[model samples]
Target: MKEDLALMERALTELHPGLYRYNTKEEFARKIADFEAKLNEPLREDRFFLLTAQLLSGIKCGHTYLNPYNQKKEIFERLIGRQTYIPFHFRFIDGFFVITENASEFDLPKGSAITSINGRTVDEIVQGLVSVSTADGDGTTLTRLRSVDLSRENGASYAHFDLYFPIFFPLDRPEFEIEAISYRSKEKVRLKVPAMTKQERTAAMEKKYGKTPGYDEGWSFKFLKDGTGYLKIDNFITWKLSIDYKRFLADSFSRLKEAGATDLIIDIRNSDGGDAGVVTELLRYLHKDPFSCETGIRTFIRTAKADPELLKYASVYDQDLKAALLNGVPKDRYKPAKNGLLEFLNGAVACPETEPYADRFDGDVYLLTGPDNASAAFTLAKRVKEASLATLVGRSTGGNLNGFNGGSYLFFNLPNSGFEFDIPVFAYHPADSSQAKDSGIEPDVNAISTASDAGEAFDRTLDKTLRLIKEKQAR
Candidate 1:
């Protein structure tokens, strides 16, 4: 336990941005010690993992995550039978624990407020669960709740909700003493429901959202009324397709031109970021001038004799750090920071200027953003906002405005517990002071989803942008 904690501290303090980003080193050390004090007796491995997760949540760095994916499945299968699960999933909407979906025997109505679980009030249970959940900058949890795709067809969207509850607050029995207020009848009621299994949950998801549940992963483009081009880029990863992202992008624009599209709407609502370097290709179509947002990047290499293995991973900067590590690196080039992490000589990387595409989009562009926008997605959004390239509509982004901390990652395994986590290396900051510190990029046109917008067939953010565009057309 001590070794694990020591390693964690070393990685965060010496190597990562914890010292630079968070409070003073002394304060962070103290907090770590305080957390360690609670584990007087050695806890079960699973519980210890949970504690670690909770502790890590305090850091609040979006890039740093404790993904216990396989461990979670194993735990669930062991605790309950391979077939047993709680049958119901919930969503927090408008300050209420609304039962959005259930496959249990009991007819638990939708939109019912879950008052309590096993005599514990909803608030108490949520406080415990959410305490372990990590959020970016402001600790605003609204985005976290929305980020969970409760619908099963969306690749275990409810996995977090399911695993954490069962792991943190174990339910031994098949049924819970559920106290819920029905949204329809406005009547208080109690029900005994059967626990569901993995097979059952999957079946339920298919039954609910079988036909085109959610957009498949890739680039999709279509024309709306009046030559309005709608492009929903699910992700930047186009490796699965025969053609690369460049081809897909070019083809998309070609189709738009063929269709005589006058306006474009790029929906990146739940886009949790991807390769930002490739995003410049998309920007080339929109940008009318020479553009570059990356001011400089800082690479922390603590050990002079760094692992040659680390060099296996490449950076956008084409960093050949192995040579520097093998040979004596001159400290004169790098301005030493407060920490002892290997510092790279701060230098600006101006991206190559590209002229507007031959078929460059000359119409109004609207970007749909939300809390799920992080990493490269946030970078694109930031660039859009900075260049006045598009009218952003939706909730604030999940990624920070100032910069990102991801060029490469170093994985560490816990000494005793065998748990592992990744620490992202290289701090990428913006070119200027025009960005917000630790805060996400706010939308140009503020548009939050209303209660009525919840689970509506219509897309609220996109719809809002479309309405505004139409109004402009009418005028």
Candidate 2:
């Protein structure tokens, strides 16, 4: 156990570029030592995973953590593949656990407030879960957003809450003792709901809501009654998907132009980010001038070769790492920079300024941002705000504007327990580094959604944006 802990410490210190970006070396060492102390006795795989997750969360990089999906089949089955999940969908709204979808046989309806689960208060469970959940810097938007997001658009087999809640707060029985306040009558009631396996929960959801669009069909465009074009992009991961995103944007904008629409709303509130190239393509149709996606991609390690000890338990996902290990990191690709960091020279540098698309929309633009907006989506929001390309309406976004760790990754598997954790190899920084590293992109117009909004299927952010546009047009 101690040997594994030492190896993890070494891997993070030697390979992780942004290891100290949010925490000091001394603080990190202290954390490692604390965890090491806990290793005096052997721990079960689940307990070890919980401690490792909590330790990794201190890194404050959203891309870092033990990914449940990446775990081996046996490890996954032992840790997460069980029938111990809350039998309902809920979101944390204004510190309340509001039911968004009820899957249990109980009479609890949507918008009902769940004050407690199994014997723990909602607040206690949330705090415990947040401690182990990964997020960028100190922001909790992504953590909160992920807690209730059951959408399979991101290709996850299970919800975040379903995967983590049981591990963090294990239940001895196969049922959840739920105490909820009714949404319609405001009456408090307690019920013992049977726990559900991933398959059961998925089957229930399908039976209740039917089939929804897959990730490939996550993008759509339509015109509002007021002649406003609404372009909704749920994700930017078009590289591997069947969707031709560039053509989609081009056609959507062309339609808007032909309709003579002078206002456009690009909704990315549900986006958790994807290919930056996709983001750049979308910007060409909205941004007036050429803009670079990032200043540069930086990494602490110059060589892609992994330490043999760590490499034994690690797997390479991208070809870059594989090629580097076989031959070498192409000399022309990276150069040593100041602060002992290696900077990718070719495509990793600030992208060259490409002129806006010939048919770029030259009308009022508004972007809908929210807690789920992250990665390349966050990059879009930052670029739009930095260049004054659009009016950001909604809550603060998930990713930090200062910079984030991504571009490349290193997947590590703990030798003792087959738990897998991801570490982003490179860190991408914005041109302006003055922004707070721990904060997210604040919206120009704040419009928070309530449990009632979710229950009624109303979009408060979009409504506020339309009203704001209407008021501006009235002038």
Candidate 3:
């Protein structure tokens, strides 16, 4: 037990002490002590994992996370060992968990405010979830939930929130009651929903969201009836898929340009972010040279010293990365800012030098953003806003523009529990530090989804974006 904790402490000490990266060494010690005390208790593996994950979530670093694909999958599987999941979809709008769709056969209509599940109020569940949730940059649990837009039908936030929901409200029974008020008629409704088997849940999700997720495609560009081109970028990553993101963007702009489309709409809503390569690639077609994605990166420590085990898995290598490992370990709280390396938390070298596209879209660019526009996507929005390349219209971003912490990550396995958590080696603050810390990139024109808007299945943010796009085109 002592050995396991010693390992944890040694690992915890790697985070930047100056930035209070996750928790101070002292605070981390307290949390470790408290968690250690729970080891003696008759805690289940699932519970222990949850406890540790919640502990790590406190750090609020975007890159540092117990990979949900890895740890979160294990937790969800164990939680549903015997019971099935409450097979339905919900969107948290305004303050209520509204029924957007269902995977199983249920009486709940679209837009019904789900007040409770299994006798627990939505507030109580959400309050508990905040601690377990992964939020970005000084965001509270509520802010995290809202930023993710927990109430969406098929979004990145909903996907993550769905994983923890069953665990947070452990349903031992085969069935549970849901209480909700219909948005259409203002009538209250109650139903006993049966749990869904794994296969059943998959089918339902496939139906609720198309088998090919609406936004799953790399990207798409279609000209609106009004001659404005609408390009929806669901995510930035394309390495896993056959799609080439760089080529996709170049072709997209070429087609739009050939069509002589001037005004454009980019819906980054529901985008949880992917490779920053997508951001840089998109920017290449939009901005000129002599610009950088960020001023510099800050790094107090490096992952190699703390969790060297992760070094073997650091497959995303380049000249910059090899140089760092060869240069010897970072001794102090700061490492020399290396462009194209994962050493600096606030990376000095965010974008690789790219000459502007000989012919790029110079017409008005409308970037639709929200709480879900995060990580690299949020960073892209920051660049666009800083460069004055587009008019941002939507809710504030999920996390801040300048004070981002993403770059590289290493997963640290808890010695005692054997469950794992991730820690970002560096914290990246922006070169332009004027933006208020703890706030996401606020929209130049702020708008949120209204109740009436959802009822008609309308996108108020996109509408506002198009209105501005047309308005500018008129000018």
Tens digits of per-residue lDDT for model 2 on 130-178?
A: 8876678876555454645444332136566776788888889889998
Worst 10 residues of 3 by lDDT: 148-157
The 10-residue segment of model 2 with minimum total lDDT is: 147-156
Q: In model 2, what are the clashing residue pairs, if there are any?
A: none
Q: Judged by TM-score, which candidate is best?
A: 2
lDDT of each: 0.65, 0.78, 0.65
Q: Give the candidates in order of TM-score, highest first.
A: 2, 3, 1
Which regions in candidate 2 have their CA more than 4 angstroms from the true location?
Answer: 140-156, 290-306, 325-340, 343-350, 430-437
- TM-scores for every predicted model: 0.84, 0.92, 0.85
Error of 3 at 388 (Å): 0.4
- Alpha-carbon runs more than 4 Å astray in model 1: 69-84, 99-101, 105-115, 139-141, 145-149, 153-158, 176-178, 181-186, 211-215, 238-243, 296-333, 338-343, 430-435
Q: Give residue 421's lDDT in candidate 1 (0 to 100).
A: 60
Q: What is the lDDT of residue 400 in candidate 2?
A: 80
**TM-score winner, 2 or 3:** 2
TM-score of 3: 0.85
Residue-level lDDT of model 1, residues 1-475, one tens digit each, is 8677766776666556533454566767777898688677777765767777776766666666565532345444554334435566666555556666666667666666677777777677677776676555553455556533344434243355565666676767756678887766778988766666666776765676463234345467888866789888766544444556677679888887777777899988767777775568878888877666444444444444444433332122334443554464676655555554555564443456566788778888999888778778877888888789999998888776555567655555665656666566566544453544657888888886543333343467887898989998999
> How much is 301 displaced in model 3, in angstroms?
2.4
